[model samples]
Target: MTILLTVLGIALFAFGLLFSIAWHELGHLSTAKLFGIRVPQYMVGFGPTIWSRVRGETEYGIKAIPAGGYIRMIGMFPPGEDGRLEARSTSPWRGMIEDARSAAFEELRPGDEDRLFYTRKPWKRVIVMFAGPFMNLVLAVAIFLGVAMTYGFATQTTEVAGVQKCVIAQSENRDNCAAGDPVSPARAAGLKAGDRITAFDGRPVKDWATLSDRIRDTIGPATLTVVRDGKEQVLHATLAKNMVARKDADGEVVPGKFVPAGYLGFAAKTEIVPLSLGASVDRMGDMIQNGVESVIAIPQKVPDLWNAAFGDGERKADSPVGVVGAARISGEVMNLDQPTTNLVAMFLMLLAGFNLSLFLFNMLPLLPLDGGHIAGALWESLRRNIAKVFRRPDPGPFDVAKLMPVAYVVAGLFIGFTLLVLVADIVNPVRIT
Candidate 1:
């Protein structure tokens, strides 16, 4: 049964991935068509076509490999200087440039002269290129907000789960209470397990973090409103100062670091609960920040990923996860010892994370990615505006084809990194369990 569940999970994830890829390409296709740029093919994968049909001017198809997708826009690059599409290359680097230029014009139709992508205004070109990654971002935001505001997420609530028997400094790290220790403020206030805190010091507490922060910053008499047995009750207690684990701005405790703060002496209850729209947006912002940080940290993680794959280093939980690794985790999530709703939520969150990763990854301003083209357009627009202001001759469209050699190198490095990640994923897969 577990094996079947795992296989089922993998299949579901593969379908979701294909849908995501297609959705990404759809953005480019729609925007290109809207701008009257001829797109000859709208393919949802790489390699040989598995299924295809001619639809108007475009051949919409699914390919054998479900790795990625593309929309082949006609005349993606302007003609070379000297008013010609043909190229004569005497060097290898020039060959790369010519090859790229030739491919960009390979599907050029007669009427495509005016409809070429480069003929469009720079800002329009930017929108056409930016649309793909923007679609992914939209999908990610929708999925994240939907899951958060509907199915909700696992969170620590203001409800009390357990009360400390006595005051103990975090540095002590012992469960047993010492005779010299004072009674916990929670115990003295008669706060018990299952008591749901509604307010602190007359201020309504909507979440655990707020209540925790309020407690940490206050060390005197305070009022706590609790709901026990469906009845609201207020209790007054004098909070104590103690050395507790220091928390960062995000309210996460800093490991191995303690600071003097107000002590509440009780652990918050953890449960899956829905968030308000405001809270969901706040969470989305945090995810975006974390995603950006993760992208920035990729270069540093390569060494660790290589060691984990080829050497005997243990696979860390924070290790980068490739498609294979993520699918495996989805399978594990399906087989987890949890309720069906929870499992579904986990799967959806996995899909959301994948979409978010896709958005971040493609937005990198490097060749072959959407952001690179957008950057080129922006640069072209800037240069053209400066020339117009100076009453100088138009410099014309920036020949992005000239950067093919650099693009090739970037592509090679990306391929190498992807393969390394693949090896690491298979050898030392990051597991949920």
Candidate 2:
């Protein structure tokens, strides 16, 4: 049964991935058509055609490989310097440019001169290229907000989950009390696990963050008003200075990092609470920031990934995971001994995160990606505006094909990195512990 469930989860993720790819391509197709450009083929995947049909002027199909998809826009690049489409050459660099130029006109037909993608204005070209990544971004935000406001997030409350017997610095990383350790303030004040804190120092405190902030700001003594067994009582205790996990700008505790703060010696209870729109937006911003940071850190992680794949090195939890690893994780999540709603929520969150990563990854201004074309269009726009101001001749559309050689190099490196990640994911997959 577990194995079957795992397969089911993997299948579910595959469907979600295919849908995302098609959705991305749809953005390009719609925008291109809206601008009167001819798109010959709209494909969802790569390799040989598994199913395809010619509709109107375009061939829509689902290909064999589900890795990625594309829309075949006519005249992606302008004619070569000789004022005509170029042919293949013996020189590899020249061949690269020729290949790109050739592909741009592969589906050229009657009346396509005005419908060519390169013939469009630079601003319109930017929108056509940017629409794909923008679609992924929209989907990501929608999914994240839906999951956050529906199934909700586990939030910490002012109710106590546990009371420490003695104060042990968080930097020590040990929960058990040791010899000569100072008695915990909560324990000394007769605080119990089920006690609900109503106020701190005669001020009403509704949530855990406010209470925690007030507690950490004090060093000597504080008053806790708690409701125990239908009776409200005030308890007094002297708080001690101790090392605690430091929080980042987002108020999330950073692991293996500590700072000196007043210790209350109690654990806040956690409950599933639906998020407000403002709170959800804040969390989304934090996610985007973290995603960008993770992308920037990928180069540094290559060595670690190589070691984990072949050597006995431990795969850290923060290590990068590819499509295979993500699918495996989805499978494991489905097999977890939890409620069905919880499992569904976990799956949706994973898909949402995947879409967010897609949006960030494709926005990089490099060749072969959507951002690369957008960058080319913008550069062309800049040069044309400068020429117009100086009253010089219009510099023809930027030949994006000229960058084909560089795009090939980038594509090769990406393929190599992906293969390395695939091996690492299979050999030493990161797991939910």
Candidate 3:
């Protein structure tokens, strides 16, 4: 039964990812069509066409690769030898220059000059190029808002419901707590389960963040104030170095033991923030921004994120994941017996976050990306205006073909990074508990 559920979940996740990719491409296709740009092919995925059909001068189909999709607009870049301008009867030099100009435009079909993408104004071109990433961003916002409305936002509160009996600590020596070892500080301080922590180190804790900040800043020993069974007590405890196996964000492992300095063997109490409609929207926006920032910082701060997550720095290569990982996680979520609404809410948030990352990553201004095209269009527009001011001929559109080498480098890096993440995901799959 679990296996079946897992399979189902995986399938659903793959479908969702594919749908998202298709939706992103659709944004470009629709906008281009709206602006009267000719779209010859609307393909989901890359490589050779797996299934396709010609309809009204467009070949709409699915490709073999399921990674991403694209709309082939005539005149996406400057013209080449095979472009329309080259076929015209003209001098060799004139033909060469016109060919370059034509290649700059996405191509229209033979005798279909009316539908050419290059015929559109620069602003319209910009709109068509921006639509894909814009659609992804919109999808993220909607997903986040939906999840927030359904589950409410998890908020930290000062009221603690439980204390840790055994905590994981970092140590090269044998004295550190191992797996299943009882947390020494809480035990030594006579703390028990169901204790309500009210303060730490003489500071009134209003939330987990405040308590954690205070605890982490304090080194050596500290006093823990807790209320148990209607009685308040102050217990002395010594902070120990924390160590455990963990992975960094780039999926690298940094193995070592370090002290957390001031530490408390306890978990935070979580409450739902009841948000008004406007507040919910605002909160969702904030969440989206934070999500984007985290994705951007992943390469640099992955180690810290891994340490925070697993408690030990053991960077592994397979920590990053692709669609396969998403499918696996979704499958696990679906297979849960009597899954709570909160669990589903968490999954939804995860999806939203993943989508947000996808949106941001694709927006990076590099070749073959939506942002690259947008950048190219903007640069061309700027160049054209500057040229006109100087009474010089337009340099035509930015030549994407000229960026082929750079694009290859980017593609190679992407593939390499992707493979590394895939390995990490397979070796150490992240499980939501």
Candidate 4:
């Protein structure tokens, strides 16, 4: 049964991936058509076409390999000097430029002269290129907000889970109540487990982080508004200064890093709790920031990735996960001994994260990416404006075809990195268990 569920989970993840790819392409297709740019093919994958049908001027289809997708817009790249679309070049770099320019016009129809993508205004071209990644971002935001506001997140609440019998400095790394240990404030104040702290000194607190910060910053006498047995009650306690683990900006305790802070003597209860729309947006913002940071840190992590892939190194939990790794995790998530809602939430969150990563990856202003084309259009716009300011002749469209060589190099590096990640995923996969 577990094996069957795992297979089913993999299939489901693949379907979701295909849908995301198709949705990304659909953005390009729709925006291109809206701008009167002729798109010949809207493919949801690479390699040979598995299924296809003619829709208007476009061949909409799914390819056998469900890796990535594209939409072939007519005249994606501008022509060379003297309208040289039929250039034959022996130079390798020149061949790449010519090849890209030639492929852009291969599907040119009888009436596609005015409908070419490069013929559109710079702003229109920018929108056409930006639409793809924007769609992924939209999908990511929708999924994240939906899950966060409805299914909720695993969060530490203001409710007390446990009360310590005696005060022990967090830096001491000991749990026992020793002979000379002081009585904990919570225990001395008669604060028990299951008590829901509503406020700190009449200042209403909704989350654990706020309560913790308040407790940490406080010393001497303090009052807590708590609810016990369906009745609101006030508890008086003297917060004690102790050596506690220092908390980072995100309120996560830093291990092995101690500082003098007021100790509250109670642990927050953790549970799944839904968030408001404002809180959901804040959470989404954090996710976006973290995703950006992860992308920025990828280069620095290459050595560690290499070690984990080929050496007898530990595959850290925070290691980068490729498609294979993610799918395997999805399978494991499906087979986890959890409730149905929890499992579905985990799977959906994984899909949402993939979409978010897609948005970030494709938005890189390098060749062969949606961002590269957008950058080209923006650069073109900048040049035309500068020319107009100086009263010079129009510089015309920036030939993005000239950057084909650069794009090739970028694509090669990306492919190599992807393959490395793929190998690591297969050999030392990051597992939930």
Q: Output the number of the TM-score-best candidate.
A: 2
Q: Write the per-residue lDDT of candidate 3 for residues 1-433, one digit (tens) a residue.
A: 8888788777767677777888888889899889877788889988988899999867899988788888887765545545444455456545544554555453445776666665567788878978887887788778777776656777766665566566655454454456777566767787776676787876667556567666667656888887888998888888754553343442223576243355556656677755567867887767767666766766874554345344554433334556766677787788666447765776676677667777788788887677776777788889999999999997776655556556667878777767655554565556653
Ranking by TM-score: 2, 4, 1, 3
TM-score of each: 0.95, 0.97, 0.67, 0.96
Which residue runs does candidate 4 get wrong by more than 4 Å?
A: 202-204, 232-234, 248-256
lDDT by residue for model 1 over 1-433, one digit each (tens)? Answer: 9999999999989998999999999999999999999999999989999999999999999999888999999777777888787657799998888888888888876777888898999999999988888888888899899999998988999999999989999998999998899999999999999999999999999888889899999998999999999999999889999999999887778999999999979988899999999989999999999999999999999899999999998888888898888888988988999999898888888888898899899989998888889889999999999999999999999989888888899999999998988899999999889
Candidate lDDT scores, in order, read 0.91, 0.92, 0.69, 0.92
Count of backbone clashes for each model? Answer: 0, 0, 35, 0
Q: Candidate 2 at residue 47, lDDT?
A: 99
C-alpha lDDT of residue 114 in model 1: 88
lDDT of 3 at 222: 84
Q: Rate residue 286 of model 1 by lDDT.
A: 94
**Span of 10 residues, lowest total lDDT, candidate 1:** 80-89
Which 10-residue window of candidate 3 scores lowest in summed lDDT? 244-253
Model 3's lDDT to the true fold?
0.69
Candidate 3, superposed: residue stretches over 4 Å from native: 47-55, 80-107, 158-160, 163-268, 272-318, 336-338
C-alpha root-mean-square deviation, each candidate = 1.8, 1.3, 7.7, 1.7
